[model samples]
Target: MTHPELVIRKAVWKGEEVDLLVADGKILDVIPSSDTMYEGAEVVAAKGLLLMPSMTDVHTHLREPGFEYKEDIASGLKAAVHGGFSNIMCMANTDPVNDNAVVTDEMLRKAKAAYPEGGPRLFPIGALTKGLEGKELAPMHEMAEAGCAAFSNDGLPVKNSELFRRAMEYGSDTGKPIIDHCEDPYLAPAVGVNEGEVSSVLGLAGQPDVAEAAQVARDLLMAEYLDMHIHLAHISCRKSVDLIAWAKKRGVKVTAETCPHYLLLTEDALNGYSSDTKVNPPLRTADDVDALLAGIKDGTIDMFATDHAPHAAHEKEVEFMHAPCGISGLDSALSLTWSLVASGKITFDDFIRMWTTAPCETFDLPLNSFKKGDPADFFLFDPSEEWVLDATTMHSKGKNTPFRGQTLKGRVISHFLSGKKIV
Candidate 1:
């Protein structure tokens, strides 16, 4: 559907207040906020709000095709847009598992059906192994051609090095990054909490930081050996950070991400035995958090991801030991990450680049260029708005967020996709 010529006036973008002109679902031009008037264009006053490209999450689990009760494509896409994200790349951990072209095409079709015109785009990441079994490779090239943005074996490590090598080689051919959830299963058989003083205090099964660091070390070595790019998912420990830094210094093709929970909260949050705090490669110690902050500051860590794994209320309202490992991270992602900037841990530039350009560059996904003829995928953010998070009210079906009761600093007020306002 074609949209009328529209001008968003007085929106703050790139530290300057400018007027954006949109036509035919693309940015027509950006003009200074003068008395200049368009004769017939529909104009929406932005009220001097922060205007920027909508965020992109490279790691999210929408739970579609099989787990609609947890979160379907419609609900997940809605959640992404509400979180000020226009492009989200979902992992291949669905019930049917998006390993083949048919599944990938179907997911894309469903996403388009949900948002026929302006949409929060859904990019599917194909599974590295068939059915995510870590066995033989899936028809990855077929899936990539179908519409997959990247390849991954999330929720499980591709433990077999030989198979992982073939998958990386395949990813190289396809020009997409291979996202890996680094973990040594044998070492961390139980992952209720971080293995340390907290686990000993809570008497829960714990996963040590080394379990993740060990896999990261192995993956880095493999990436260096093969001269292939590997994206490490959810680095929660200092050991992993050190290894990633070593790899980057040696010019290894590696990019890494960490979740908001890891940056702000720690294993101490698990002391209450809340299942929401239970994430795979579980939250690490304060020292690890500091190390992660350092990595983010120095550019060792490439971007931020929600790892937005959603689950049913009953699923998370169980014993900590039995509850699934994940956090429904999309809804409040921007606000929480902005807090890091608010505290001066990372510069505002780093925050913007990580959320917008970094993930797009890392995964080879589409991004808003904010230039003439480019799709106008943008959002209006209120940086000073403080709102208490209510997980049950979030757009995603699952209400399993660790930030459930906390007050966050920033939020999205409106979103425009391809020049049409969606939220």
Candidate 2:
């Protein structure tokens, strides 16, 4: 055989020491580093670095087509690469929104054209309703034809039960799942944080846990009746997880995700109404965080996503309720997650499975592994490294991160996409 174009020596492949060979955008083979040498290949040493499948975030908000002040396709893709993400599925919450085929196709073309440097593959989700109005369904078939991977109305939940059911039915034929931001607007109007002692102490409006569970219950029943797969985004409450787990036990085809902040932080972060700590489904108490971690370990919570929402400085620099409901997470998720895993709160393999394999399986993408002939997508991580996060040094356009100056573990030194390097 011809000499491989790239050779990564002394790396751990699925936890075993081996040399990985790549050519023409695919892994050609994995052999003992000391046993083989390609005379003409560009060899790189990977000793003591973890070689695992790259992350695939199923919930990301690029804020393109209008909100360039927050983020654009180019900047978002760059952040994805720096964060060690090889595949990203974006929500349909753009300016005009991704409700039509034209918007979907344009976003696809923009992402493909902007990232010649081998960033994460873009999988755009189309809107479920026109303008995400929660009244009329968009052209589901047409948008799917334009190559959307799924359908969603993130940043705004579909409040109309009848309209959502119709969208779910029409969306079933597209072979893609419908993702819902399950929150009942009526119950949580103008709410700034989780309805509890924290919101009461702060003298701010609160959103009850029932607000989220109500919508989750409605959506689950809808999915069961329609025989469709439904994905819940950024589930924070313990009740929501319990419901989903119970539903799964009864054999409902449903899956859910929680962001790193929700799994790590709690309402204590919002004690003084600092806008940075605020987020949708609002951070819960320490008990809630404990529940989320347990749910993750036990297979009730299927995956972990960044929910990497970004906003401009001015947008988030206002009073609590007037400020935006998200923070930039792409660059922080892995390191924070690794901290818990390293402390034996969760296994390292569990971390890999959630950030890599589970999301791909849920989205119907090919499962990522280190086997030969698979796409050469993986991250070279120094699991023991420690670093303090600095938002100004981040590659993401949005500088609104909550973990500023906090020490985190497990940094990605390099990322590979196909046969080329992205970081």
In terms of lDDT, the best-performing candidate is 1
- Per-residue alpha-carbon lDDT of candidate 1 for residues 341-413, written as tens digits (9 for 90 to 100): 8899988888878898899777766677687787888888889888888965588887898889888888888
Model 2, runs deviating above 4 Å: 1-3
* Candidate 2 lDDT for residue 14: 61
List model 2 lDDT by residue over 1-423, tens digit each: 546899888987666888888887787887876757677788889999988778889999999988988999888988888788888889888988899999988898889888855567898989998898887898989988898888987867887788888888899988888999888888874364888898888888888888888888898888888888899988888888889988888788999998889877888788777788878878887887888888888988889889888988898899988998887888888888888887888887788878888899888775557666788887788988888888765778887777978888888999888878878
The weakest ten consecutive residues by lDDT in model 2 span 364-373
In candidate 1, which residue pairs get closer than 3 Å at backbone N, Cα or C atoms, i.e. clash? none
Which residue runs of candidate 1 sit more than 4 Å off their true CA positions? 1-4
Per-residue lDDT of 287 in model 1: 99
